[model samples]
Target: MQKEIMSNTLKILCADMVQKANSGHPGAPMGLSDIAVVLSHHLHLNPQDSSWLNRDRLVFSGGHCSALVYSLLHLWGFDVSLEDLKQFRQLGSKTPGHPEFGHTHGVEITTGPLGQGVANAVGFAMASKYAQRILGENVISHFVYCLCGDGDLEEGISYEACSLAGHHQLSNLILIYDSNKITIEGGTEIALSENIARRFEAQGFDVFECDGHNFDSIDLAIKSAKESCKPALIIAHTVIGKNAVGVEGSHKTHGAPLGAEVVAASKEFMGFEKDQAFVIAQEVKSAFEASIAKGMSECEKWKKSLSQEVQSKIAELQNPDFSQVQYPAFKQGDKVATRVSNGEILNAIARSYSGLVGGSADLGPSNNTLLKNEGDFPKGRNLHFGVREHAMGAICNGIANYGLFLPYCATFFVFSDYMAPSVRVASIMKTQVMYVWTHDSIGVGEDGATHQPIEQLSHFRAMPNLLVFRPADANENIACMQVALEMKAPSAFVLSRQNLEVLSPVSKDQVQKGAYVILESENPDVILLATGSEVNLALKGAEMLKNQGKSVRVVSMPCMELFSQQDQAYQDSILSNRNKTIAIEASRGMEWYRYAKVVIGMDSFGASGKGDDLFVFFKISVEEIVKKAQEI
Candidate 1:
């Protein structure tokens, strides 16, 4: 009876919100009401203490199911009010159509993009385990539960995360699939038909089946998952619209609304009073309120246990200092490519920073994310994010949100576009997730324009609250990494695919200041500014001008975002509009017009050839830089 009342409240809330917004997904919420009611009412979570260290995590991988989530949160005593629901999909409202991180109070990860939440759940599971192992004791031991749909399971990213979850045998992870056999396009059979349960089973998950609309079945399935010592997946078969009259059991009602008239008729069919708005039975409300105190009591017990554990292991909990996770000891002449230097620094940081966890988007070896001799994050130390770049980015945010790991995600710079939204949200939250992007420019020869990142550097630089650093040499790369390690906001390190020389004369301190004096010139006529692989070009070009009797200053601008934050006087000192300036880089010059007198940038797409030839074709050579400077 309590379950029935909870289900009615969820359905009513979802219908009202969508009807008011005139723009939202109603089918999923209606279909998933039973599961939502069961989890919110019966799961081992405390509404009174939302951030309990060991509280069960609920991630909605099928984010379009947000209506269902919001309804549950509202019923279960989050800050969301009736007015907040009324303001759904409106500007500045917390209850937006798609769940947004920081926008909504309890949304675990910003979901919207299909399958991102699924991967985020994997990260959450990993973070909890890592926290327990490093922080010690059972201070953090809770299952990461995810509610997904056909769209989520169909996405490639889900497969990637699931594979890693299976490999690590993350028994604390549980996924509940809402198998309604429908998508926006039509029957899922029209597009996809794969053995989902068998797939998860092969991935080493304990699979269960149940009737999604049956509260008893869902409750028992979740219980089975909790008891299992391995990751569990429950495929709950359900109707598209469980009890919405004519459309109750069909795919037609999966996306479109039942209309006001149809909604009225459906309400009658479900034995509800006519024209009732946001209706919830008093009995059901009382029942949920009764459980609130019980949930609070259980949460308090967990809190006491955590407090006791902290007291026993104060030293390990406090100074678990991971500030130096994956970096090398700072030295004057650390000669290595930015990518190589990144790996070395990351390994060093990993040694001390137990919370430093991350993985590559399937390009582990190429991305240089694997640590030497250090254990793979095999569901234990590091993360294996598979090939899902977008999901990997969002999941990294979740890992950071776990308040334990300073999560870093890696991949080629070009592919970072796919993961942009996830990284963007991380920036909004000021989560210090390190983004390691290798193959920074047109230097990725033979792979052609598809692989070469002509506009990627500019793209990252465009994002607000993000630090985009492209190091000139090995030492500068180390310096940039040191800065990333210390940052409180999101940072991206762009490295070259080609091996670069270890240039001398620049120190780590200078790089940390954002722009440094690579070569000072008295009475300089022009400033040659460069980043990444092109920094050496600027130096060589400056030499050519020097022989020609031109006093040229070379400045390595590793991080434009950081440099811009410097005092106005310092900015003027480093780069003056009064002084003729030539900026050189290997990527598109779209972002360089603002700072240089004449910008030598890759204006066209790259071709298949040797890296040097590609550089020549793109006019990214020191000779070109010298010529451009001479012209200026």
Candidate 2:
């Protein structure tokens, strides 16, 4: 009786929201009414202790069905008020067009982009398994259930992440696919007709099919998933609009709300007293209250365990001093590409840090993101992010937001454009997600313009609160990683694909300080500011000028974000206000306007050629840099 009442109440809420806003996708909300009832009423969740470390995580990868997710939250014991539902699609309401994390009580991750949520669920599931391995099975083991749509299946990233999940045998991960046979454009049959169940079976998931409206089938499938020792995917067959009389079983109902007349008729069919908004019976309220109480009891036991376990683990790991520690020491004059240096530094940090996880977007080998002898995060330390760069960025953000792990994702620097959105979100959220981007410029030679990053650095630097760092040598790379690891904001460690001689003058302390005394000032008439590969060119240019009886200073400004954070006096000291300054880099000049009198940079696109030829073509070589500095 309680289940019936809650399911009907959910239907009413879905109808009310869609009708009031005259917007939103109501089909899935109506179709999955029973699934929502079973998950919300029976699934383990503690609203009062939402941050409880061991609670199960839920994500709606098919976020267009947000009305269903929010209605479930409201029906369960979440803080989403009925009034909030009434204000759906309005400004400042918790119930928005789609679920947004941190804006709502129970939303674990912000999921609007389809396949990303599935990929993030893979990360969450992987983290859960690793947490149990590190912290003990009894300490932290919880399920990660994600509801996906046919759209999610088609997004390409799903295959990449899901393939890895199956390979790892992440039995704790459960996917509920809403196979309603519809998309925004038209019936999914128009473009998609492959057997999704067979595909999941091939990918090594325990696949199940059930009637969407049957609570018993949904409950049994979920229970089976929890018991299975492999990842599971329930392809629940459902109608597009189950109760909408006009468009039931059709794509027309996929995204639009039924009109006022049809909504009233649907309310009557559901046996509602009237077309009331946010209607739920007192009996349903009592049921949820009882569920909340039960969760509270579970919370008490978990709380005691977590307190003791976290402390003991912290002691076991000998938690490093997180309060502004010194950078790793680096001797001067070591020639090393920043990419190789980055790998060395990350492995060094991992030796002391237990929670750090690093991976590349299927480019770990090329990007040099693998930790030394670090087994594939295989249910443990490293992650293979597949080739889904966009989802990889967002998954890194999700893992960081979990707060239990320090997450890092890598890809070629040119692909930073694909990851810009998630990276920006990480910066905005102030999450410590590190991005290891190599092949930072035209140095990616022969791969042509498409593989080279010409304007990405400027794009990242233009974003507020994001650190864009390109270290010159192995020492600077190590220092840059250290600073990025310490920052609570998103940081990009840009590296070259080509080998670079490790410069001998940059110290670890100087790199940590951002702009360091790479070359001492000789009361120079001019100063050379450089980053990444151009720093070596700048040094050479300075040496040539010095030979010509010119006083010059060269500063390696690897991290603009860190440097800008230093006091004005420090900045003025490194980039002398009186001295004529020339800033050089192998990328766009957009962010160099304030620090240089003349910026010798790549303002135009790059093309395929030998690395040396490319450098000459762009005129970013040492000779060109020296000529530009002399003119300035």
Top candidate by lDDT: 2
lDDT of 1 by residue, 267-349 (tens): 77666875986776777666666655566777888667665547545344324554434445444444466787788777887
TM-score per candidate, chains pooled: 0.90, 0.89
List lDDT for all candidates, in order.
Answer: 0.78, 0.80
CA lDDT, candidate 2, residue 290: 69
Off by over 4 Å in 1: 135-137, 249-257, 307-334, 361-366, 378-380, 384-391, 414-421, 442-451, 497-517, 520-524, 564-572, 607-614
Judged by lDDT against the true structure, how good is candidate 1?
A: 0.78
Per-model RMSD to reference: 3.2, 3.4
Q: Spell out the clash pairs found in candidate 2.
A: 332-504, 333-503, 333-504, 334-502, 335-501, 335-502, 336-502, 377-382
- Worst ten in a row by lDDT for model 1: 315-324
Error of 1 at 171 (Å): 1.6
